[model samples]
Target: MDDLRRIDLNLLLTLHALLAEQHVTRAARRLHKSQPAISHALAQLREIFKDPLLTRRGAAMALTPRAQDLQRPLEAALNQLTSLLREGAFDPHQAIRHFRVAMSDYAAHLVLPTLVKRLRDQAPGIDIAVCQASREAMLAQLGDGEIDMALGVFPDTPSNIWVETLFQEHFISVADKRSLPLRGKLSLAQWLARPHVLVATRPDADNEIDSALAAQGLHRHIALVLPHWSASTKVLTDTDLILTVASRTLDPVLHGQELMQFTPPFKLPRFPFQQAWHIRRDSDPAHHWFRSTVMDCSRTSPQSGEKQAVSR
Candidate 1:
């Protein structure tokens, strides 16, 4: 096509490396190309874009204003190109790659550790990083390569982003051992009357679960707003306030807490937890491997109505 001829796609990629390393030798090493070939690509790029994208400094290269502006767009394009050329079929056991992911404290607690060990044995060169990032930031992180994927919920997520439901995590009432609720399932009337603690990744998240309860014309009383479910375990153990948390959160010990699944005060929806990534990374082999590992963790975790017992 005409578009293909005008844009020497390979030049965009060479420029990306040149701009990043600020040295042809280093960039050549990264791209696994000969230094002279990268130089030729840079020359072609300068003529095509009609700008001296980079200039020589004392011992390194510096970007012109035009080059500075091209950083994000160029990196995004090359990453896309490289991802497309990558073998779509991912092989977990033989692959060597880095997979950086963003997840809530809850998900990190419930997942990842198991996979890290498996990756150690199955794919020794594979590197993994799991850190916390808000849903608002997930999209930008995915696009920029700061994170290849994120695990959590994104109810009001934007359309530009892509999400796959990893699993349906159900809620269970959790409390401290001293104040654990009755062992048997409590009736809806009994549940609504008790004071409760609500946990969320963000302030608006509190409203999400509350709004769902409002739709049924039945709502539970919330006595506290906590930052994470881990903190709630401490509250529920020391106090009688029922904390509605995912049953998966029960795995990690919290100073001896007791968890019980009680009949909801009304019909409660399952937490539609999922892993979301940008469309740009849809074809990346490394990204695919990381996502598949997380999905495997989710599928293997306890499913509906099953109980997990834990202690400090």
Candidate 2:
């Protein structure tokens, strides 16, 4: 008996539309259900709660006190449920969709241009909004459903977010051609001694170079800090101002200019850069397309030198 009564969930949805509109005809249109169906649902709700859910004043029907109490929360719950059902199975090729992706300025330096091209080629009508930020806030926004995806080296975040490895890259340094004092390659020592710019601004960072420097019991001096890798790269004019970056992404941005690549002075662990999205969107077709597309772009990015093999 309880199961039977509990299973008629449609009544709740109908009740939601009825209490909100306060008119049988309007609620029917809103629910795509007939006026008689709404009237029947109102009766069922009255029986369930033992209260008239709505009352009439002239032609306008006002919600009863009980209905008013239940209105907003009920509407919010229904809206969330509807959003859940409608979230997935979005087709990229035909659907006009815009998705927001969060990434660091450094991460964007390696992947966005190619990702954009792929999106345009595969789904012309689709659009992307790239938001660059630190990993923590991005992950929080992802959990709260404010952000759709986050890109970069988010190696060990929580389990609720899905991380797809985009690439594992060998970090290196780049400098302009006219700027090179001497060189086919600069040694790790020379790399470390030069004025280097780090793309980290946050107070605490799991910085890749710190690990690299720690390995050799040495550290690079930070001459400047930029919010994005693009700015750092462009700032590496002809001077000896060296830019620490992933080797895989260096060549693409280096237009055969006087730029150079060198191994780091110390043995630092390479970072695995991945794309993350909330688990809720795991089955979403458009999100699936975006994930695969990012992986494809990262893997075939000739600019990154070696293709990063994706792992889950």
Please tell me which predicted candidate would have the highest lDDT against the true structure.
2
Cα lDDT for residue 120, model 2?
Answer: 81
Considering only N, C-alpha and C atoms within 3 Å, which residue pairs clash in candidate 1? 176-236, 176-237
Model 2 Cα RMSD, 1 decimal: 11.3
lDDT (Cα, 0-100) at 299 in candidate 2 = 76
Q: Residue 67 CA error for candidate 1 (Å)?
A: 23
In terms of TM-score, the best-performing candidate is 1
What lDDT does candidate 1 reach at residue 82? 69
Each model's C-alpha lDDT?
0.68, 0.71
Where is model 2 poorest over a 10-residue stretch in terms of lDDT?
303-312
Model 1 off-target regions past 4 Å?
1-85, 88-96, 143-145, 176-189, 217-219, 252-259, 301-312
